[model samples]
Target: MGNQPSVPQPGTPLQVIGAGLSRTGTASFSEALRILLHGPVYHGGTQLTLAASSEIRPLMDIVSRFPPQNASEKKLIGNLLKQRLDGYAAVTDAPFNGLIEELVEAYPNAMVICTTRDAESWVKSMKSIQNAVTMGFLRFILFPIPGMRHFPDFVDLMRKQWWYLYEAGEPLVAETYYKHIDYLKRVVPEDRLAFVDVKGGWGPLCKALGKEVPRDVEFPRINDSQAIDRLAKRMVQEGLKRWSIGFATVGVVLMSYVFWK
Candidate 1:
């Protein structure tokens, strides 16, 4: 049964995997699951940091949270955590088989979803976030030196993330944010895989998941990087102003002390 179609038995919990960008229609899908079926859906929230022992527990716990529901779900979740934390599998260069296996097994009796936005849009959003983070970091390190060059071209910084992706050997990581969609198409039965755009909203998705859309629940959109970037910039500007004022105040106090002495 290593190689079998993902056919979920009726009335079992659903599992959704992948980074948020996978566009699996998680909130809508999860909301639908919670309403229609009492299954607890688990989505991965943080980057996998192999160094922290504390980090591994969260990953393991999330996987373990799924009640064995069946022998298959039990084994699938087990293998998923094993492969996920293994050093080699954490790198993009490693074949994606382990994670793929978990997805296939866990999602068999349940609807599994994966998604990707347009490449250009993904790159733009990624760059905006990266720029804000890197700029903040650079300011901290360089503020003391006084002559260090500041960063230029947030786009270039964004490009570096793509390069890092390539170096990690999953160069197509961004391009194939929807790769799981293809995987689900090829491996899981056509009826099971729901390859869809989140932008299309809840109606089509509810129908695909075999549930009726709730009229009361509007699709809760999240993490729009464009909006996030705008907010990050505003916060950064405010932080800089605060830092500048603090520096000036300290400098004035030092001068007064020196003059008085």
Candidate 2:
């Protein structure tokens, strides 16, 4: 053999890749499939980077300067993930193809599972995540700022960037997601593409993936819109009260200054 690559033997369990929004049931699917297939499962696992402190450090604010599909960068990320999942029977929720093609390419024999949900729901989930991140930033700033205080200018720049992205980024992300899903579908063939809606029932999904339904497979439903709407209305009412108080205080201060002068 002249540096020939080895192929997976018959009956080796497939590799499952869960791609999509944060709350889209990747974890649930992975767990269910793992039990059904009788394989080792790794979920959303990340390798430590120099930028990510091993201590009580905050999340790394990656300024993705390039689109995820940049071959070389994708290769590096893929290699890192491949190394992490070396002995694992399957992996899931490991970012999109742009960020993970290398890992997929390396394990060509494994099944490539890509999951997606409704676009509107995906956008909402993304919005919720961004809002949480923004709130976290505000809380950190109120606490005299965390990583940003070290560089005031950088913080200001970051805030501006975040605002711009948060407002304008969703459509772009949605477009990219659509394209990536299409790409995976075209490339991986029907047998490998585990096209599934997390909202869907577990029995059919298990059948599609060549696995027996787990006796106790519990698919946890989350991110209901009705619940979010109630929370939003409550926040708005509180906001209006705060605004009213501010207006009253400003009016009193101006009136006092005029009378004294």
Highest-TM-score candidate = 2
In candidate 2, stretches whose alpha carbon ends up further than 4 angstroms from where it belongs are 1-14, 45-76, 94-97, 136-168, 171-177, 220-261
Candidate 2 pairs with clashing backbones: none
* Steric overlap count per candidate: 3, 0
Candidate 1 Cα deviation (angstroms), residue 160:
15
TM-score of each: 0.46, 0.54
Flag clash pairs in model 1.
Answer: 8-108, 8-109, 22-115
lDDT of 2 by residue, 151-244 (tens): 2333333344333323334323566456656656555656656667766767656756677666765754433343334543444455455567
Regions more than 4 Å wrong, model 1: 1-12, 15-40, 46-98, 129-174, 177-181, 226-261
Local accuracy of candidate 1 as per-residue lDDT tens digits, 1-261: 001111223444334332224223333433444444444333232122112223334444433334446777768675665445332111111112214445566445545444445765655555554555456364663333222222222223334433433332222445444443444456566655555566777766667666677778766565444444554565456557667888999999999999999
What C-alpha lDDT values do all the predictions have? Answer: 0.43, 0.48
